[model samples]
Every structure is written in C-alpha cells, then in structure tokens.
Target: MAANILTDPGLMPELRRVDHGFFGPDSVAWRVWTHPSILIGLQRAVAVQFLNPFFTAAHDDAQAIYKYPGHFYDMTLGFLLSGILGDSRTALQTSDFIMRIHTRATGIEPISGRRYHANNPETQLFTHIDGWQSMLKCYEVFGPGPLSPADDHRFWNECATAAELFTCKPDDIPRSRDGVREYYATLRPQLCVTEAALSGMRQLLATSGPNSTAKLAAFSRFATPATLITLPSWMRRLIGFDQPAAVDRAYLPFMRGLLGTLNKSKRATRTTVRLAAPISGRILRQHWAAGTPRRAEVATVAEARKLYRQELRDENGFSSDTEYTAAH
Candidate 1:
C-alpha cells in the first residue's frame, strides 16, 4: 500500500510545511479528515446541506450547484480540505475566498418569500456542523473504527475550532454529539422541501453536472448509492434520496473495500487527487503549488487568524487592522 498524497508529505510535497494550522496532527479533525472515506462524507453532506430551503435557493440562484454540480462539488471539497490540511496562510485565504463567495450568494428565497444570505450565522453554522457530522459519521462507519467516547467529544469540540474558518463563532457550534442532535431537532421544523432543493439533490446524486465526464457518471452509479446510504432514512426521504435497505446491505462491503483501498494505497489516492484537480478551487491549487509549512508548529485558531490578517494587511497596504477588516 502506498501513502495518501494528501496526508503523507513524502507524496504531496506541498503538505510538508512548518505550521500545523488550526488543528494539529494529533487532533481528531486531522485524524478523520485524512482518511479517504471522508470524501464520501463530503459528498453526502453536499446533498444533506441542501435540505435547508434557504441554502438550496441561494445555491440555485447562484447557479453553482445545479448548473455545475461536479464543479460545485469539487470546488467545495477542495476549499474544505485546504482549510483542514493547508497551513495557516492557506487556510485563512481559503476562508476569505469562501466568505466572498457567500457574500455574493444572497437573494430572495422563493419559498419563504424572505431574503437569504449564505453567510447568515444560522446557515453557516448549519453547514459547518452538518459537514463535520457527515465527515465523522462516514469516517467511523466506513473509513476507520469509531472513536472512543472521549475522542468523540473531542471531535465535536474541535469542530468549533474549525468553525472559526467561517463566519460562525466557536460558541455557536455544538460541543457534544447530543448538542448536535438538539440543534438539528430545533432546525428540522423550519426545513422545507423545495423543487430547487430536490433538483439540486438529484443533480448531485447523478453527478450529471456541467463538464462531468462519462467516466465520472459511471463511477457515480456506485458512489451515489454509497453516499445515500450514509444519510439517515428520514433525511434521505426528506431530500428524495431513497436507497433501499437491501441496497445498503449489498453496497456496504464494496464501499468499505473501495474506501479502505484508497486510504491505504498511494497510487489510488494520487489518482483520485489528479482526477479532482481539474475542478479544484483556486486556493487549493495555490496551496498545492506553494506547499504548507514544513515544521509542525501548532497555533490556536485566533493566533493563526491574526497571521492571515497581518498578511492581508501587508498585501493590500491597509494602514490599520480596522481598515483591513473594513476593506475585506
């Protein structure tokens, strides 16, 4: 078995860098995210995230998802992994890019007759927590064994730290598994199914987005079912992703085998990254070229964020931090 290009710096020289960014190698985030199976989790979250009508509407209006599903998926995953694995500078730049994207994704939501903004704390928090939940859920069931109780708690706690990359404050993110469930339960009643949401979900599940090759579509036959089974039946039904229990039973082993191979085989991981590179986001591509820090220097989210701010200030010739913030 070869090493994963994303994790082993020996393969991805760019991964070799000094700063560990927000989460260190020992953190639960790095532990789970480095696994190949988390890619499934990310795909699953792409569908699940649209369960929010506002999010779906915003995405639909932006013409990012339905119009360009494969691009949307790859770009989202690219930015996400960059934030997790890139050094402090890359992560902060990725976050700023996301913020700009969110800023422009604002409009009247057709269903509720209310305006929707992607950066709204409620929306951002939902996306942030749901993504973490999806990643960890898939990682446990298929990638690696489940975390211990303490580690499980730490995963959720660390999720808050990761949330700093987005608009959400740490306090807004759930610190426990139960807190996540409670947050979802509270948000469930407000979630409504819309045609845009269903259409976007179908596009994602089919992998039939613009510029998606036939090979990718063929792979989606196996990958989509695996992605669907990761979601709970209720949520699946809510978003019209209905995979039978028998399908789940039949595909579970294959999914596990496929992901396990990717986790272990360097050639497989490298191939996957190469396939995804065409649609990768700018920050992720830049990070790949520039590489991360070589030394494992850990920094708190706040401290790392200040570095980003300082760099931004220097680049733009902002006279003060306040001016930098305002300009941004």
Candidate 2:
C-alpha cells in the first residue's frame, strides 16, 4: 500500500506519555480527540491561537507551506498527541524541541508595543487555554454530544494538568465551561487581530485547500467555513472572515447535523480519525499532480499518521463504545 513505506516499523511503542498524567485515556481530553469529529476542535484551536496578536506575529508569512492551513492539522495534532500519548521521554523531547524553536520566534508586536517570544510562559498559556476550550467546543457540538457541566468542570481541570507542560499553573487556568467564558472576558482587553496578523491569516487560508489531496485535507478545507462560523465575532472580524450573520447561522446547523449523523457510526468515524495522515499525504500528492508545483519537502504524512494511529490503538485498543475510555 502507498502508506506502508511510512508504517514499516512492525510494532507499536510500549510506553506512553500520559500513563501517569490526568490526561490519561480516562480523561475527557482523550474522549474529545478520539471522537468522530475530532478535527473540528483541532482546527478551531489553531485559529483561536492566532487571535492573540503576539502569537500571530510569530508566524512567518514567507513560509507559506509551513504556515499554511493545509499543514496546520498535522502539526497541531502532533503537538497534542506527543504530549497526550507519547512516552514521557519522547514527550519531554518534543517539549524541548518546541521551546528551542520558539527561542528563535522572538519579535516585536507593532500594535501592542510589546516584545513576544513563543517560549514566553504567559503566551504559551494563552495557547494552551484556547486549545482546551476549543476541544470542548468541538466535542460538545460535533462529537458524541454535550457533556454535563460537572463533567465540563472536571474536563477543564484535567486539561490544565496536561497543559501545565506549557507553563500553565492550575489556578491560572479555567475549571469549567463558564470559567472559560470568564477567562475570555479577561483577554478581551489584550486581544486584537492587526493587519499583520490578518496577513498571516491570509497566508494560512490561501493555501488551505490547494496544498493537499488527503480526504482529511479536503475535510479541513470544508471545515474552514464552518469553523469560521464558530469563531467569535471579534475573531472573525479580526481575520476579515466577513460572511453575513445569516450565512453563519445557516452553516452551524448544517455542519452540526452532518457531524452528528456521522457520529452514529463507530466504525466509520474511527476509520476517518485513524486515516488523518494518509488523507493528508493524498492531499499533498494531489496538490503536486494538479500543478501546485511543490517548492519544498514535507516529511511524509502517511508515515506520521501511521505512527499516530499505532500509538492510539495501543493506548485505547479496539473498543466499541465510541465514548469508550482506554483502561488506565
């Protein structure tokens, strides 16, 4: 098969990063990512991170392939998956690699008159928090269904623990959906999407669909419009995703309905989730074949996705309950 070159390693790794953390298979974060509509929150989290101007300044527009939305799905999933599922040693390596990369991500924010470093704990905290919030948003709206407020509180607490790897203190993070709402209340004063940020956004969106042929890539491109519908009015305005309010209102229901129906099938949804990489690879190949003329090399998506699926299966095993938790 075309994906075998990437999955040539015969067996899955035995160790896991979350074996001792609250984010273990029993956690809500696990439940959120394994859901049929996992991609929904994952994409939204990427968009939400850019709402912070300092974070936005870190994206280099010239590196369209790297900064492109087509690539966002894998990159984001890798970050979370490494921390959430990789062995402790691998997880630490991944964290350190990111910190080292961010060390060079220092820049001046023209609008805020502030210097920003991707490694900055507070900045990283904003990203961690936003991601947790987005995960919950997608799971509630697209996955199995809405979780209880009490469960939401427990989920947020667990998320904070996992996110502590990024420097979030337990108290500094929200503990419930309402707390997330309040957390955003505080950030309203500090957040604004500037033209430079908007340009960075454009770089991402412009490459959204044309860059890959993987079904997941196509799904991501399709989700872009619906994800935009979910973005806060302020965030949408910042990036200039100006569809009429009526359009957004119409999109939300249709997307929710589509994803909900898919959630009804355990086999189909799991297959889609597991195929993220091959889908991404197919997307890339399609782009090259269709006159996109790739300028640089991207590590094989099939291989990356193969490893991810192996780890996920090893951790959770094959369970029927779509909401089934991996035995810790």
Candidate 3:
C-alpha cells in the first residue's frame, strides 16, 4: 500500500519464501489480496459491514470508532499489509495483536436481543465472508481477474484456507464460489440499513480528515465513489445507495481508465511473504517491546531514524559490508 514494500529497503524482509504462512507466494488469496487494486476490494468490505445491524449499532455508540475513523481504516489496512506480506513470525504477531483488539469490542445489541462482540465467532464469520467476497469481487471487476473458471474456484478455496488460519469456524467457512453465493443469499433477508449504518456510511464516504496530505486525501475521495460504483447493483440498492444512470455511465469509463493505469505497471503490484521468517520481528523486539521494562526509552527523531536504518540493515537480510551490493 505504501510504495512497493516488496522492493523497498528498511521496510521489507525477504519475501519470496514459500512457507511463510497460510497463503504463501503461490496462493491465490495472496495474489489477490496483495495487489494495488486491493484498495478497491478493502473499501468495498468497509462499506458493506454497516449493513450488519449489530455492527452498525455498536459502531454508532462507540465514540472512539468515529473520532478517528479514517485512521481506524488505515490501521486495519496496515495490519492486513503487515500480516499478509510478513513472514510466519510477523504474521503471527500481527494476528495476535488484532485478536487482542477484537476481544475488547463487546456490547449489548438491542435489536437482535443478543450480545455483540467483534471477536464473536459468528460476527467474525460475517466480516470474513463479506471481506473475502468484496476482495475477490472487486479483483474480478477492477484488477487482472475474472480468472479462468478453474483459477476462480481456486481463489475462493484458497480464501477459505486463509480464513481457517484466523478465528474462522470450520463449519462456517465457504469453501467454494457457489458456497459464498449461497451464504450471501441466506443472509440477504437480514441485511438492512439502520439509522446508525446510514449515518456512518455517509461520514465514511464524505471526506478524508485534515491529517491526510493532499495526495492521500485525493485518493481517499476517489476511493469511496469508485468503490460504491464498483459494488454490485443489488448491493447498492440493498444498502440504500443510489447510482444515477449518468453517474453509472460516467464511472464505467473512469474505472476502465483507472484499471488501465494499474495494469500499466505490474512491477508495482508484486508483493510476497518470506517462506522462513517474519519481517517485523526486529521492529517489534527492539522498538515495540510490549513486555519489556525498557519501553520508556525515547529518542530524538534523528536518533530514531539512525536506529531504524541500522535495524533494517541488521535484521532485514544484509551484512554491514553488503549494504551497497544487496539488491532489494
């Protein structure tokens, strides 16, 4: 997401390894989720979650969720980026961090007459399925997808396997494309726009905050409209988003142009996870030592920068004598 970490020094680990985690360099989920166009897929997933009544209600009441909504979105994106491309150890650490966060997201639901927790298996299942569908769906629409029917099936199956790596239930995983379609169909009756969902969606799409730089802010603006336009028409209607005929007519060409831009540079999209280890291990151990008494250590920006560069060289696969010769 931040300028081809696949090739960046000081930020990327050895990422061509095949055994890093669940979906390796060879897996379709990795291929699908790591691409630049995954931006659209992730945006789709964020928009779709509000249709869940319980999630909508909980999110509406949680002020922390709104105060920095864009940051919240970016944090999730970072988690996914670091997890998916990171080696086995890094992936595990990020997963643990996310799970710990989810455990705290519990609340009572007035409508369903049940308690809602972000880490609840059922809720996790819902989010996973929606997220999975949105990623694959948008890839097919906006990226180099619409895979051969065989690869398409493999994509969905690989995603199921990826899901199992997290907190997914074996019984709830959709192991095939048809299973995903059937699952969504079954949930259709339950999907509706609550006042909370509507309000959140509005704000979510309205603007990027002041903290975003101009370039990031512009992309943030394009992201909402493009993602909304890219979602299935039935979904747009289901969630009470309207697509005027004129907007639809204009958006298709714009999407085609945008997708063309993505297509033009395949090198930028190539990202991989290392087979043998985690990329973030050193960063976590040295700087973010969660349990260490030395956590209070702080430094000026210049010291921090020097320390980071040294750490990157030391832990990210290079000797002190080899910095100039090593190619990312």
Q: Best-fitting candidate, measured by lDDT?
A: 1
Local distance difference test scores for all models: 0.71, 0.57, 0.58
Model 1 ranges with Cα > 4 A deviation: 1-18, 276-295, 313-328
Give the clash count for model 3: 1
lDDT of 1 at 218: 66
How high is each candidate's TM-score? 0.85, 0.71, 0.72
Tens-digit lDDT track for model 3 on 1-328?
1222322435444332223444444667666765556666666787888888877766776744367654556555555655554444444444444554565577887678788776666666888788878877777777775777777777776566545435666557776778888998998888888777887776566544554345445555676667887777888887777668787678767776776575555432332111111222222222112232222232222333234444443444344444312221
- Candidate 2: the clashing residue pairs are 17-86, 212-283, 213-283, 213-284, 214-279, 214-282, 214-283
Identify the superior model by TM-score, candidate 1 or candidate 3: 1
Model 2's lDDT to the true fold?
Answer: 0.57
Q: Cα RMSD (Å) between model 1 and the true structure? A: 5.4
User: Per-residue lDDT of 1-328 in model 2, one digit per residue for the tens?
Assistant: 1111112222123223123222443566656655555566766776677678777777652343354454455555655655554444334434444444455567787776788777677787788888777777777765556897777877887776666456446678877777888988988888777776666554444333455555644565677777776677877876786678787778878878877776676555545555664332332222123221122221222333334444443332323333122111
- lDDT for model 3 comes to 0.58
Candidate 2 weakest lDDT stretch, 10 residues: 1-10
Looking at candidate 3, what is the lDDT of residue 246?
A: 86
